[model samples]
Target chain A: MSKRKLTIAVTGLNNTDNPGPGIPVIRGLRDSEEFEVRIIGLAYENLEPGIYMHDIVDKTYQIPYPSAGTEVLLARLEYINSIEKIDVLIPNFDAELNTFMRSADKLKKMGIRTFLPTLEQYEERHKSVLPEYGEKYDVRVPKSKAIFNASDIYSLNDDFTYPVMVKGKFYDAFIAYNTEQVKMHFNKISSKWGLPVIIQEFVKGVEVNVVALGDGKGNVVGAVPMRKQFITDKGKAWAGITLKDDKMLEQTQKIFSATKWRGGMELELIKTNDGKYYLIEINPRLPAWVYLAVGAGQNLPEALVKLALGEDVKPYENYQVGKLFIRYSYDLICDIAEFEQLSTFGEL
Target chain B: MNINRNIAISDTGFVFDPSSGDSYSLNPVGTEIIQLLKKQKTIEEIQVEIVSKYEVDDVQLEKDIIDFILTLEQYNLIENNE
Candidate 1:
């Protein structure tokens, strides 16, 4: 039987050691039995590996960075959509999601559907405001504070003990053992991801994760909990296994029901020795290891696209408990002309 | 005692739990106990077998076996049928 064809424009194509979710998301879409996808690789840089992955990405286009603002991004998308006639656009970067979320309506008017969290939903789950989100939603979150300056770092001692996690607004996290280390991390993080660095209490436990999708109607489309079997130094999962964790699944359903979250979300959680789960961070999109969920029986990206198209999707009841996904690096040999094409023409 | 039926013990003492996808490496004695448990050997039977083969006394070995069983239970290698 012939499947429905979808042209999905996806960003975050840099499939490096510190990988992005684009390649994985694309992989999930390609694996869709229901939809035959013509993947439009939306890249910010010329050298994003997914652009060169010919078998994966049908075509690649350069888009303006999110820092260029929503108008500029929408204009670039307008041009891309004119040619490709993209059905759905999935922005996979945390930094770029705000721009996409803001322009979601404009893109819809331009006939580009996107399933993304609302701006309010996005801001409420930000690292700085996680404590409040946890409190409002009845989730167990680590004690944390958002500090703007170095003076605030000194005062953190009054509220927090040593060995707190100093984190950037968007990325980069370090364990600071002293006030001096906190100040150093504060400067480092602020310099990179801007001000209002977050300092969270260090929760000692094994890191587990869940990739889930919500239909924007307080319904869980799918949820797959996983435990990392191997981790990279950059803290990305090299290999992970799907778990039969009912508690984690219940927590994910609770959060989705509470927030009525739209699109995909990854819950970073810490499972303590006493079996209590602590919500560490919530990535407002599907994670790099999302393909594991696909392997486990829940095709979240497929469900997300269905939701974006306003289709009623049945919630997945179960996934293969012990399905494992091990990611490996492959060296793709591409000619320099392909690089020159993307660099000079901004499309390939 | 109900050991997880999905647990697979390799000769090299590597234990893999299919249910949880958790793996553990056991020492020789630990491997022996797991192998014995897989056969539905009771704790007293395991204690008697280990005491006869090894130099350790029955009383001390019994205590050690119980401690090891507790650790196995903690790791979810065995079901809490108690």
Candidate 2:
């Protein structure tokens, strides 16, 4: 008997970050000859579809923005349902999480598996709750508070120092210094996003991103650490390298156990001069750049797919460490632009 | 914070930290900050130059410059200049 075709749909594939990490995860599944993959997003047309080498996607789907609570989402979801046997649904962008999470019941009724942490887990892992968890892992997460009204944020503890950052309950951040300054920023951001707002400690250090794969049984199957070699204007890490930091790995495992995390995740860590790495936030989905974990030899989406279908998951073994992958242009241009000071940024 | 170190970078934007065997790459502003620091510009001085070059504000620039210079120093990218 021929192998049954397993279909997966990835939302938010249109991000312009070059050599997108998602490609590798898709490739791992397609190349394994076990699954059929389809990438769903408006990426190549609406966004800069920078050169990519992953040829696994059987088809790419594009949908318009303002998707949630609107025709776009319904249309897209309808299109998705039209396609049979979409066993796994991976929501890639943070912005899309709200729609899918809010609409979870409906999707689950359709027999689609959501690749998110539980709702309760999401609440805890969000900006408001992660800091407390950060303390457990010795990760320096930004200090913040959750606010219902923008006015309440104004009269915060006057003892609060300068340079605090105000952010959404999720990923977006708006940096503010003084109270009055934050008030002005408050209006600007209020018009853009709805609260509860998170006020966090503005911790600074070299950003180190850790991507790990978790078996559905709550064990960290694989993990990789990469320092922020370069970041885009939108806070995307443009250029980075895979590292072999056992210390970071241990702390990551500690946090994973503490959170009872049971899926693929990305942790943003900051390294202080005192040789401490502080946790910033935890991402519950396979990040766009998840392929780095693949480059490092832990293919998450496939592992999760296998685990979800009740198949025996192969244990992840240690692989060659210290492998580096760079974007075709961003890392290169950023390097040429700053070559004069290469002595400092160049040291690795 | 002064970028009191000679930096070598790859065309692919790989920042090799010879001091700690660690490497970093810079975004556009990160690249600018490292350059101005290499010219021995003070944090405040570099902030002014950077603001004229990017959309970031003085408050952010101030904190970013100080924190970034410290980050460079922490990674042994540089320390106090003579």
Candidate 3:
């Protein structure tokens, strides 16, 4: 039987200490039995490691940053698509999702398909608006408020106790024990990720996560829950195990049903001592540990590509429980010629 | 009085619960108690075995055994208290 050949372009290829989902997403696609894939890595920087991984990424093209705006990004994609004829595009970064989503139709016209959340679905689930999202979706969430100014930190004690969480809009979070610490975190987060930093009441518990895919019409294609066995100082899961957690799966389904969410999502949840789950945040894309879902039998990234191509996908009923995924770092030795090629010519 | 049937306990005191994928290490006493429980030994039989092997008083051994059982229960290694 001949497998369908696909040209899939993926972004967020910075597989560093703070890894991106691109490499893992590419791994899932490469593992697909139904598809023979030609992976085109869309990288924003010359140093993205995925560009150097020749065996994994057939070709790598340096694209403009999201800071350059959607027009510049769409123009770049048009140029890349003219050559590769990309069948499906997967954007794996939180910071760049907006640009790709905004240009989804333009990419479609250019013959590139993308499976992504709608702008409304994207905005409401932002960390700043998560409180209302939890309420609207009927999910339990920690008490939180988005504050725009440093003075707001002084009055936070009236609503929240000390040892609260100070979070940025896009990334970065710090546990602040006092007003001074909150102000410091606020300045640091604001300078990097911009304003409306969120202050959340810290919930003490074990952190468990669910990676799930939703087919725009409220059907969940796959879901896998995992608990971190080891954590890095950056709070990324170093090692994790797939869990037999029905509640987490149910919550993920409920969120999909309520929102009619499209594309891939990761739910960051806290399970308390009393066994209640709190929805901490919703990442609008596949996580770096998403390959664990593939190892556990869901193959969400493959399902996502199939869904993008308008294929009828049967919802995955079950995944292998107790599957473990441990992440490791390895250095890839390459000559400076490869680096020079990517830097000078933009495509390698 | 019952350990989860799916649990794999080693002679060297390593306990692996297949259902939850949680692994635990046990001391010699915990290992002995868990092994006896896996064999469907009654609480009274376990108490007798511990008292005969260790130089501990009956009342103290009973208290210690109950505490040990509760700890196992907390870890969800035990099936049902009944």
Q: Estimate, for each residue in A146-169, the C-alpha lDDT of model 1 and write its tens digit.
A: 998788887887999989999988
Worst 10 residues of 3 chain A by lDDT: A240-249
Rank candidates by lDDT, best first. Answer: 3, 1, 2
DockQ numbers for every candidate? Answer: 0.48, 0.05, 0.45
Q: Is the docking of candidate 1 incorrect, acceptable, medium or high quality?
A: acceptable
Candidate 2: count the clashes.
30
Per-residue alpha-carbon lDDT of candidate 2 for residues B6-50, written as tens digits (9 for 90 to 100): 345554556665322376888767777677766778777887787
For A75-122, candidate 3 gives per-residue lDDT tens digits of 888899889999999999999999889899988999899999999999
Model 3 chain B: weakest 10-residue lDDT segment is B14-23
> TM-score: which candidate is best?
3
* lDDT of predicted model 1: 0.91
The pairs that clash in candidate 3 are: none
* Preferred candidate (TM-score higher): 1 or 2: 1
Over B12-37, each residue of candidate 3 has an lDDT whose tens digit, in order, gives 99987644557899999989999998
**DockQ (model 3, Cα):** 0.45
